[model samples]
Target: MAPVPVAEGIFTWPSDEPQLIGSRCTSCQIVTFPVQASCPRCASTKMEAHLLARRGRLWAWTTQEFPPPSPPYAGPTGDAFVPFGVGYVELGGEVRVETRLTVADPEALTEGMEMELVLVPFRADEDGDEVMTFAFRPAD
Candidate 1:
């Protein structure tokens, strides 16, 4: 089975180095993740696909101690579930992306710490294919 992205167009796939896909407002220049059709600042429909910075600073974070509700959360559950880190990482002063963090220990994570984008295994599908998702880890 082949590894697959959690969803389409969230990040660049089939590449050695992947970057998150965002939308920049052609009018106001505001950037948003998951690509938006309209600008949140100016409400303009003119938006373009923007490749976000691969590195950033951790702005804020917390741990998801429990499994998120199933409809939107497709990862492991019950005994298979594990706590993971979640945070917003500010990329190139363009935007702050809310993402999963590779480090789960809050003590190990600090605000303004340097971070880099990475792809991590999210879960296995019914077909046993690996589902990959984007995350951030402390930059060396």
Candidate 2:
């Protein structure tokens, strides 16, 4: 898998599952990933980056195993990504984030089930380097 370039001081992947660690404005209490200079809700510049939870509940999902047409992916060309579940997950005390589901069987996936984040190889680069990507796995 190719190496995915991550901007410095932008986001941190504490666990295998990457969470969009960001700061929330104390004035308006708006959550922004990457610790914005100013709050979008209250336009306050005071904010701090905080680590989020690693588990959430699946709100919805859809499989799209087809290889992405976007860049940074150089695996088997035209190879489908294999139908994997992708949907919104509500993190406890955090926010509802959209992510892909990491389940072997799509039919077994159900809404409202507990899910955990997992880091997996996204794709291989030209040098055969594995690009690590995070996905939400069903815990139930």
Candidate 3:
């Protein structure tokens, strides 16, 4: 089956180097992820699609020890669930993006460590197609 993105418009897909799709305010130059209609700083409506940096520094991190609550959480559960890492990565010193980490060990992750964007398997769709999602991993 074909692979598909977890959601639409979150990041560029079907590319060798995928980038997160964000918005930049033409008024204040403030950047936001997931694309915003208006600027948060000056409240300007002049926002444009901005492709965020693919590499960044890990600002902070934590482990998802338990499965997230249902209704919105659609991944594995019970014995099938695995603990994973989640963190905020500051990209190009412009914006901090909350993302899943490829590394899950707390002893391995450190603040200010270099991280690069990657695509990982998120879940399977109803038709059994693999769903892909964006994540960050330690840069060599």
Q: Top lDDT: which candidate number?
A: 1
Cα misplacement distance, residue 56 of candidate 2 (Å): 1.0
Q: Can you list the residue pairs that collide in candidate 1?
A: none
42-109: candidate 1 lDDT, tens digit per residue? 99999999999999999999999999999788899999999999999999998999999999997899
Instruction: State in Å the error of residue 84, model 3.
Output: 0.7
Each candidate structure's TM-score, on Cα atoms with residue i matched to residue i, is 0.98, 0.73, 0.98
Give the runs in model 1 whose Cα sits over 4 Å from its true position.
Answer: none
When sorted by TM-score, best at the front, the candidate numbers are 3, 1, 2
State how far residue 34 of model 3 sits from its true place (Å): 1.0
Q: Deviation in angstroms for 53 in model 1?
A: 0.3
List, residue by residue over 6-57, the lDDT tens digit for candidate 2: 3345335444436656677878876665567898778888887766567878
Best of the two (2, 3) by TM-score: 3
Query: Order the candidates by lDDT, highest first — what do you get?
Result: 1, 3, 2
Clashes of 2: 16
Candidate RMSDs in order: 0.7, 3.5, 0.6
